[model samples]
Target: MSAANSPDFPMFVSVAEARQMLAALLPALETEWVGVGQGYGRTLAQPLAALVSHPSATESALDGIACRAADTLGASASAPAHLQLTGESRAGVPFAGEVGPGQCIRIYTGAPMPAGADAIAPVEQLIDDGPDAVLVQRPASPADVRPEGGDFRAGEEVMPAGLRLTAPRLALAAALGHARLPVRRRLRVALLSTGDEVIEPGQPLLPGQVYDSNRIGLSAMLEECGCEVLPLGHAADSPGALQAAIDSIGGADLLLTSGGVSMGKYDFMRDLLIVQGRVSFWKVRMRPGGPALLGGWNGLPVFGLPGNPVSSLVVFHVIVRPALTGQPVQTLRLRAGTAFRGLPDKVAFWRANIVGGEVHDYGKQGSGVLRSLSEAGALVVVPEGGSVAAGDEVDVVLL
Candidate 1:
């Protein structure tokens, strides 16, 4: 169906409409119990709370002497305060006796502050006098010490559901005494690239044939989004071959294919799905990826991206990826380094490198120029009928 004629056939849709269709079609996956060690990059299935209070007991935050705050109230360089050293307290070893009015304990970082002591005078502010005495030239207050549960309290929520865990997040979970975490089950994606002229990489290419890169590129992007990819390899342009490939996607959560979605005699993907009236949208009203396709197959969601390398990647970034991650597209307004003329009929996304708030476009904007996309860090978005001049603020989508 042509975009101009398919009014009731659901031909071309705006970017926002495409996203809304994906949101309505896909939902969050099920949950699973995974060890914290294996939780990195996985989304949280449930809210994660602290299992126990961090630093459950009062502990010294630095290498210091633990003493009563009152004893150092008037301490100064000229009128230094002197206290008797009753004992020493190192991490994992507590002092045997309580600190009296004139007594202090030699303590190291992470050591428990002795009983009756309310301050930690760092060693930098103390002068050790023999084995039993120390002189303090400055006062240390309770502010210098870490109290019980200073980091996190038991049962306090530290991570909310749907959050992708990173290294820092995993560290936080570990500090909260978590051995395992509740995270979403890994998403399985069936990947395929269809074209009779497409050959596998590393194989000698014949005339009129190019190597298949969409499968590898899309699979890498999917893995980065925490998906387990089931590579269905390449499919020929014939209907029998495509049907075999489709049937091979046995248990995957979603089907993602590139090529053969446009309006051409050999564009079998669109025609096959259009016959069943399963295709929701056959085109996107966006540059570089106008031929993108979204549809359903045997109750599974399918995303058919354009054949061009850059178009496939861009459509994935703007459509399939966000749906898989359950994350909204984040747009930033940045200063443009050059003028950008918008397309009168479609939304345009130009490959550009953004550095320190300045957006510089890559020289070429061709959907076939994959090298241009490789050099870009973001996509400078130009709305239909909108133009942006140099130094003007424009919307940017980070790649």
Candidate 2:
């Protein structure tokens, strides 16, 4: 018998236990180089350092005259400091001449300060004195100058490995002189939804058949977790069909199946895994997703998620995501907007949204209610035997 079927093994494990168990079995994703512009949503494979310092020299942060801070000391609107406007500077065009005593340069945002200039006098705070002079009405300090290496310096590490490259991060890399980035390859998963009653949308539905909502929801969520989903569509509840689907998982890092994990006669995944595959764990001790399993077959990890759309999503968030990606689902603490209770001996994830600094649970936390998952921005966690009342603080996982 497989380990999951062993009497000494716990058929149902705690959420933390499930994660820890799976962690040891997962492999580190490989990495590759991709253009920086196409790196969005990809995880970095190595720490990246800036190649060159930004603003290589002292520059202006605003449209203003670059001046010696000492020149404007004690000056105000009533008694302004007057200086000769020797030259002008704009982005990528610097004034080549030096600013001597009683001299300043007209500069726009991001222009390097001319030699000997130590501050900026904003255009709004300066009086244009004809074509060759400016009057600064306020005191200026070195603080007004955007110093060299202010944003980042050469050789400074700006990004660490395993960080997902979002738009801002990609922009940062691009600004730091990176034309391409080394990012982890997206994990490819073969997804199959089992059940004779399940059909894809736009198909004619029979009396008992339903649209395959689980596949749609899980596919999108998997992509959000940075996995490339190879959707195999729905499979009939038969061993022959199931085995065929499993055989087609070639080249995929994982096989993700929805349904067929429960104990009913038609449920074949858990037993089939025990008989032909190595089952690490079969069930998680959590509400809405207790019927979940993780194991390996054909040298690829298999994650059997519950068929109910919400339960499938919850399982993915609570266990599969971090286990597969090595990235934690982000979490935050929010106050409960209304009272709620947890499962007697299991952890429960209630669909919720943050509003006015409080958690508003979407109505009905049922496994079948896909709408709850759709409308929620977060999931409020309640431990076993725990009860939350108005204003009660609880940890929630962001969706």
Identify the candidate with maximal TM-score.
2
Predicted candidate 1 versus true structure: per-residue lDDT over 90-135, tens digit per residue: 8889897999998899999888888999998999889988889999
In model 1, where do residues sit more than 4 Å from their true spots?
1-7, 73-80
Instruction: List model 2 lDDT by residue over 377-399, tens digit each.
Output: 88999898887888899989988
Measured against the true structure, the TM-scores of the candidates, in listed sequence, are: 0.91, 0.95
Candidate 1 — which pairs collide?
A: none
Worst 10 residues of 1 by lDDT: 1-10
Candidate 2 overall lDDT versus native: 0.85
lDDT of 1: 0.87
